[model samples]
Target chain A: MRSVALQKGLAIAVPALVFGFLVAAQWATLAAPGSRDVGIRYIDPLTASLGRLQDEQTSLKAQLADVRAKLDQLQRAGAAQNGTVRDLSAQLDDLKRRAGLTDASGEGVVVTLDATRAAADLTQDRLPCFAPDLTDIVNAAWRGGARAVAIDGERIVASSSVYCVGGTIVVNGSIVSAPFTVTAVGPTSSILAVVDDPSQLSDLKRRRDQQVVDLRIASVPAVTLPAYGGPVVVRSATPQ
Target chain B: MRSRVGGAAVAAVALLLGVLVVSQFRSRDVYSRSLEQETPESLTTLIADLNDRNRQLREEIFDLQLRVDRAQSQVSGGQGTLEESQRQLEQLEVFSAQSRVTGPGISIRVDGPFDDHALSDLVNELRNAGAEAIAVNDARVGPRSWFAAGANGDLVVDGTGVRGPWTVRSIGASDVLYVAMTRTGGIVGQFQLIYQRTRFTVTRENALDLPPLAAQ
Candidate 1:
């Protein structure tokens, strides 16, 4: 009877211990770096919350536009002094000078850059929503001193991402389909220098000449930039 | 005899517990090891290094994909395609977008002696007032970021902690955002109405990048 009891204890304890060990190992694996269940894997914020947000933005913009239009009409009727926000030329010029672009207008050239690769493989870099090539020209243009700059029609702002999603330039809040024209209000000379710098290895052009995504520049004194509307989204450093 | 055995077993259990406790104190576990990685620069450098390496790997993948079309591309033939690709990719990576426009807007640096809660409240007010992107030092304040006061009195908006003179850049009608932030029933005024005193540096710039609303 004692032997039988001892044998039963051994069988139960041994299997229980083994099962416990396996469970622990599985937990550890799941919690490991680059883990399957780590929850660190990214989810697209756009599709996740964007649809709802866009609807909200649309309504807000419509209301704001309505209010502004009414106010403008009222002012035109001489109800009060002009309350329109003045153009940001001085600020634009300063930022332009800092960015190395000069302003232009009237039948100027528009340069476009597109990713040579397909979108399937294009993923977000450490800084989300930014592509390497896009950063280069924007920076070069800024360093080249671009005046008023726009990606598509959305005015390129501080922290604006020149990113690729499946092969399109996702600038501002809109999809800027390829031939990403970065229109800058600046001197054509500086814009050309940026696209054709010998020291920068004339990199933008290599892409341009290869007909991969490259820079094209033209000078115009009257290139009109559409006004930016909607809620302003501010981004800062990533949360630790 | 039973009592004697029981006492001995208890003594053994206690001794084992003591040994485990001592071992635990001596062991360099996750928390202790992570201490080295806790430094600000370590994390930022780690992030930057990872970005560069990731970029390198990406360019390689792109090249490989292109090579798939041809029987033999330079990548496998010791063409050193990787290095050339990095050269092309490097110049563009450094100038991460900050402000790419010529504009007049506001630079409302909202950080002060308040705790993280207060700082978050202030920031949210600015956003609700139509403020654009806000960068606290290196950290970008998106929905993913959490604002908290660190062990050091610095108000960390994102992973990056900031203190006085914490610059908040917004590309909207600055005056409106400014008034709303400080207006009664607003964040700044609410805190002031409650605490009676709060100090911060708020300036308005005519131009600031309201980057596509942080991709919604």
Candidate 2:
């Protein structure tokens, strides 16, 4: 009787053990931090590299500032030494303004372009603004008699390049995400007229009407645009 | 017979515990590997270092190019080309935001609740209006400048947190920027139509001084 009972119990215990083990295993799998229960996803190496590059650019910018300060001091000292140097220094200042290297504040307008919350949540293609759209705005600003134009503080010069990559706009090698603010320093009336012109910034206006982009334009008493921070290397160009 | 039953129950419970432990260990190992590999703190520092290195390299390359041009101009015995090179160098210095600039412009103060998207749009509008230089709360805006919401939900520009009310200084015609900003059915107008609690104000300044991108 004892042997029969032991055998029956063992038979029950074996399946019970396996069932319990299976349940436990499934629970364990679900509970892990990287499992379905956790929403955080892994970042790929390409993103990692982009992050690293941005960091490097910032530190280098600080160094560039230091070097520039020293150069300014030297230039000032040279200006003190001779009349010719002083005149040349003045000329240099004018050139700086033209080169998009000097930060200047003057009468202008600030236009803000942003994706509606809904649009931003959608696919990149559905987003209202792209790199070319900004380029068109810059052109319109120029037509409006803008002396200088900058996008999100990046001074746009003759050599400045604009492109879109992965839903971000890159201007002069800097990534500009929306809401994109385009500041143009020029004649207020002309800028306003241009901004109001149905033909001017028509693409943006169309997108706004289509509910793809949210755009804002305002005239302030004063505005300041930062100079370009990208390298200006003219390797092959010669004087005309 | 009772002992046999109790022993079986105990054996089953032990088996369950053992399986749980092994499964948990394996799952954790596998999922954790799939999770984000780097910590935020580490990524921040790494990015900063890399940006610095890249800037330095580009600067070095620029300096070398300038030297080559200078030498070539001298070898060619063209004083005009030399002058042209010198002029270009000076222009590059300013264009690169190496020099400080100041002038009459407009200041747009966005007292949040606002997002990075809003600020970007404002900047774009400013550029369209012909802003020469711009700064967001004193951090000079540049080609490398980027804005994003930080982990703490604050707007960060180029890795620096910008506190509100965010002041966007653009050197340009203050009146034009003001009108462009406050025009009816424009950005500010549209913003008011949606979120009524937020304040967007544009002030025209007679003189605004924007420092260089970096002084360090």
Candidate 3:
């Protein structure tokens, strides 16, 4: 009986020893860097790296803003002490308005241009909407005496470019999509009348008639156009 | 005596076995947490986000230089008034995140894959929910911020690459924002419909800081 017990003990102990050794070896492999195990991987380094880069970028931008604010303050102080500079400053304000550098608010018409759901449902050769459609509407609004205009809240400036990039509209380096809401700050009736004008609405009406796009024009009591966010690209062409 | 010796050896082996097993388990845990292969879609999103950010930064820097030039040219009587107006405008812009802003806010953590449009929609929801200011993983979402497919086809905000789990912070009524985000058919609810496995959480704090466009 004692001999039998010993045999059983040996059987259990030997297998246990082997299992432990196997576990140890597996542990070593898993602990090693670049191990093939799927479960052992940590955070994606690309994500981490990108996060770090963005952090640096944010810090730098804040610093730049601070510096600009200080410099602006100094220049303003200098202007306060000078005579000709004050006149120039007043002119600058007007220029800023014309350039769309400042925000504006007034009675205007809000025009919404959206791709028709039907157009999206059906496969077609030509797109239901185009950048020119937006451009044309903007031109019409201006013709109707719009002092300020904005597309999806992005103020349209002299240097602002409206073009198509793969079905999406690029406005001032930003991508604006269908259901574009164009707000014009001016005489509400005139703005609405301009959009309603047959000649001005010819292309938009045609698109609507062809079931290519949907248009909505409404007069609002008050509309605030955001300041233009894009850079003043022109450096040399000074009032010529 | 022989029985005693055999029992001692067995106990020693058992202890060694336990240690090895425990070590293996720990190592496996560590290994799984260290590295992961990103899907091509996610990689694309990251690259696109980076490119978009670079473009935005470049444009912003150009704008800043123009402003500085305008400021430098200012030399007269209304100069003080101009300065005051400018100072006020800068403050307003900072508040609007036209410039960078830092203040108290709430943070929402989202995990797993998400669509670019959905993220933008989520931000919109937050705004509707009364969030005064918002940021995603430190990226500020201003008026011009957009969510689009990158060159590699990943979702990016403005130019910042979005990856799960995204941390979103908003300065507003924390409770309102939380309820709005987690409400049924709201942003969080909508996100769940698309990604069942995704995790969404919101934490309100007295002070949540957000950087400006550049730092965010």
Cα lDDT listed for each candidate: 0.43, 0.63, 0.60
User: What digit string (tens of lDDT, one per residue) describes model 1 on residues B1-216?
Assistant: 754555455545544555454334322121111111122333333334334333433443444334332312332343323332332222111112232322345665544446654555454445445444555544545422345446667775434456654666654566786787656656555666564545555676655543321221
lDDT of 2 by residue, B21-126 (tens): 6655453331112113233343344444345447645775567456545544443442323343356454455444555667778888877677665566666666
DockQ of 1: 0.02
Q: Give the best candidate by lDDT.
A: 2
The clash count of every prediction, one per candidate, is 63, 95, 25
Worst 10 residues of 1 chain A by lDDT: A119-128
Candidate 3 stretches with Cα past 4 Å from truth are: A1-74, A124-127, A236-240, B1-216
Chain B alone: TM-score in each candidate?
0.44, 0.57, 0.54
Q: How much of the true A–B contact set does each candidate keep?
A: 0.01, 0.10, 0.09
Worst 10 residues of 3 chain A by lDDT: A231-240
Please identify model 2 stretches exceeding 4 Å from their true place. A1-44, A121-129, B1-57, B60-216
| Model 2 C-alpha lDDT per residue in residues A13-84, reported as the tens digit of each score | 676667767776676545433233233233455456766676666666655655554455555555555455
Candidates 1 and 3 compared: the better one by DockQ is 3
DockQ, computed on Cα atoms, for candidate 2: 0.06
In model 1, how large is the Cα lDDT of residue B99?
Answer: 28
